[model samples]
Target: MPENDRLRNIRKETLSSAWYTLYRYDFEYRRSDGRWESRQREVYDRGNGAAVLLYDASRRKVLLTRQFRMPTFVNHNPDGLLTEVCAGLLDGADPEAAIRKEILEETGYRVEQLEKILEAYSSPGAVTEILHYYLAAYHPGQKEAEGGGVPEETEDIELLEFGFEEILEKVRNGEIRDAKTLILIQYAALFGPLRPVAREIQ
Candidate 1:
């Protein structure tokens, strides 16, 4: 089918472009019954991003980061401190390269072997962001510097490493609330290096 076969009168207006772009889209939509309806929706475009879950299979540990998020703070998150995998906006860079840089900047690990696992929209309803997810192995030798996020970006991140079981407990207790982090951890438990531990927990 043609991309716009079902509708017409599509138009968009830029609502804001201060930090990122926010667009208001007005279009006609074809319902299932073949009736056309006019609709309007707002979309926030902050560019695409990439994230990586750094793990140590030999020691059964995973590295994560803790940082404050203003959005979460205003949305009833008590402290707004989120525990998540190392992630960053692609900023026009390749997904793999972007994730590699993020791993170094947020966790101080110079990882070379990254396995791309998933690509997903951060929030499909209102945001235009596709997050590229990856998994990589890390060891003590890969720690080249103290990774606490870039000061220029006003990022104050704390590195956290936990045994596989301990991290799973955090997940069960709601300590790990970040969506990307939760998804990656669940993926690891189901099909990645943490499979054995997950099975044991069951």
Candidate 2:
């Protein structure tokens, strides 16, 4: 341990089965200084891994999915249909590989190039999920399947493509409501225009 390092204490932890699609867990910890703490952490507990939010640069648009989320249903919406970028948990795969796989699985959109934008924790205070956001470019003929998502996973998904104005409208109309999606969209709005050109002919 380093001299400047701080000590953290955990007093208790409990995990429930991942009913539906969400991981359920409870935790309590106490610090070395005698302070006590408690929290509920979500994730497989095998490990915390990477996720990605994919963006399309040339279209000046983003691809998102509308799927039912259990947590959202519990909180407010029984419908719980959420609009989110192509994303998936990285069990052990590299972030880029995970993004590519998820893109294929979720949207059936193939990419020729992919670039990393940022890596961040989904929520530091409780959960142990991290996201590696990415941007990629795809051509018109690349979209393949209906891409409704996996059925064994119980996913009922609708693929959607949104222009900048459309997403801004969604945001203004309170349609785009997920936190991670909000963050990624805002990041794109402020910085998307700066993305490098795919075709630079000499």
Candidate 3:
């Protein structure tokens, strides 16, 4: 959907084409007083994505991933390895299907049940990607393989299994920084699948 009338005269120019597309936008922003001003902005279009927090009720553990992120490395992360939920671009698949496939690839979890929680723009100010969020439950018998993502994609992912309560502390202490991952974990802890687990903290 396009922006409403508060914005006008949108002009977009292609600026880069590496892993994702970047564009420069020149537009007119209408003031509340009915005045208008010229504005310019840049947006990165990496396409939309889906992510899920996978949990095992019996073990009170959650599935997470650890991998190097170049962006964070350059941004002062001595170790670029990030703890995150299973996530990936939709790439033409429906949101539900994409998260399921991501779980299988990133963690080897073959999930049978999924609960979609919310959708949000993780970085709306500069990025144009909307993320679909979900929660999934898994068991030992459902692990189909030792998943480390596809080798061709340069994905050398490491699996991280943490007790639900422990991971929340990781989040509180700034150990988890990936936006979507943090959101999903907190979602599960506060209002979604893992609410009971979080409640036990009190």
Candidate 4:
């Protein structure tokens, strides 16, 4: 390894486990002004994951999910139930493959084609997670199974389908607060295939 390029004396200690792993990290950093500083921070790592925004252009509708998140609950969220896009941890699988399985379990939509939007860090400050964003076209005919999430995983997920335009309104009004979900909604509004068309006066 190169000597004293930027970071050095790296160390980590495990904090917790279960669905994800938490670690406390310590290292010495070389600042821009050629100064060395020691720093430490705790990071939560559940591994990278994938998410999708499913929409039906014909009906102008979108599919999302609602579920109780323990973290949200403990952090002062009233009910802890969040409305979000279908998503799941990669769990040692490819991003696209993982998302396909996740969507199947969360929304019952058989995704044949998915447009990868981008990859993002959920919270780089303290989370070692990269979220792969995606968008897919879906219709009622594509439903394969009842998508309430995997029962064995103890996921009590609820399927939610709403008007394409109406959901964005909820986002603006502070109803939908999930970061990934909000990103997908704003992306769909600006660049999705189901955008509304404005007609010129005849």
Candidate 5:
């Protein structure tokens, strides 16, 4: 089917700047059969844009950043530490390129090749952010760059390299508390035909 014949019309688009930090919007549409639908989303409304989380398959490990999240601090935990994949807002660059750059900056591990595995909304009903997840294979080595996050961003980040089994344990224990991280870890665990249970100590 051609693009024009695929759908009927977009009924509405509501765009707004949120909390003076994020950009959020929604769209309402009508399909050919007169069905109405809507979706709410955000795209780096705070100028961060799109982001990628990478899994290094060759090393059987994942790269994550441990940083303080303000919201988490205010609402859930005081420390607000988040263990997440290398991610950043798009800043108008290509998503794949962004992932590669983020991997280098955050973990000091350069990724030569990246394979996109999934793209999903952070939270459609509330936040407009979409995440692009990827899997890249890399050999374990030293920091290829300065070794940590860009200081100006107040990102006192620590790089963590963990094998797949180790990471799944954290997830199962609720230690890897970030939503995106959880989703990506589960996706990688199920990458093959047989989805095995994550290894976690009881």
Candidate 6:
């Protein structure tokens, strides 16, 4: 049976809409034993987003960003600062187009060609955000502006560049803790552009 067929009495209530949206879902779920149980879950709909790893194969370097994340700060991050790949909410745009714009807005690199890696949900149990992942090659000549994110959005992003091996070391030492960043780095190590160098170091 389809998953939807196992659910009934579905209803949603908006809990908050100030930022994105928080919805409470009440429904009856059919269990494996054929019993129906009432359940409620709060889901956050912050809209889908995209992320990209900008690398220069010749130089063996990758471009990343540093910014303050309030959620991380409140949880346990020492200073709320996190190093992450360039990313942003899609805001109703296509994944590729959105990521390309984000790359320019956050890194100042206008890359013409992007290789999409995969798409995954950020936090399926609570957040309704499917993040598209991409990889793009970039060089200094592509810099068009001093990208620090949009001023009106209060986004103060700092661009950081690190050698491929240096970044992998950071990942091992627990310095790079962002999930999306980790995913892209691991992908590069296993099968993407950085595979050659990554394998050499291993």
* lDDT top scorer: 6
Q: Runs in model 2 with CA error above 4 Å?
A: 1-5, 8-14, 17-60, 194-202
TM-score, one value per model: 0.97, 0.74, 0.95, 0.92, 0.71, 0.97
Full-model lDDT for every candidate: 0.92, 0.66, 0.89, 0.87, 0.66, 0.93
Query: Model 3's lDDT to the true fold?
Result: 0.89
| lDDT tens per residue, model 3, 1-202 | 2777899888999999987999999999999999999999999999999988898989999989999999999999899888888899999889999888888888887999999889999799999999999888899999898899999999999998999889988988998989898898888888876789678885
- Residue 128 shift from truth in candidate 6, angstroms: 0.6
lDDT of 6 by residue, 41-68 (tens): 9999999999999999989899999999
For model 4, the superposed segments whose C-alpha errors exceed 4 Å read 1-4, 197-202
Give model 4's TM-score versus the native structure: 0.92
The lDDT, on a scale of 0 to 1, for candidate 6 is 0.93
- Runs of candidate 5 exceeding 4 Å displacement: 1-44, 47-59, 192-202
Clashing pairs in 3: none
Candidate 5 vs candidate 6, TM-score winner: 6
Which residue pairs in model 5 clash with each other? 23-45, 41-128, 42-128, 48-89, 49-90, 50-90
Q: What is the alpha-carbon RMSD of candidate 1 to the true structure?
A: 1.5
Lowest summed lDDT window (length 10), candidate 1:
1-10
Candidate 5 Cα lDDT to native: 0.66
lDDT tens string, model 2, 1-202? 1222332332333455464234544444556886656655554443333334455556766678889898899999868888887778777888788778778888887777776778887777655677787766665578877677788988778988776566766866798888777777666666663223212210
The residue pairs found clashing in candidate 6 are none
Tens-place lDDT per residue, model 4, 1-202, is 3446899998889899975899998899999999999999999988999999998888878899999998899998999999999999999999999999999988777878999999999999989899999999999889999889888999999988888667866876899989999888878777775445201111
- Alpha carbon lDDT at 139, candidate 1: 98
Off by over 4 Å in 3: 1-3
**What TM-score would candidate 6 get against the native?**
0.97
* Candidate number with the higher lDDT (2 or 4): 4
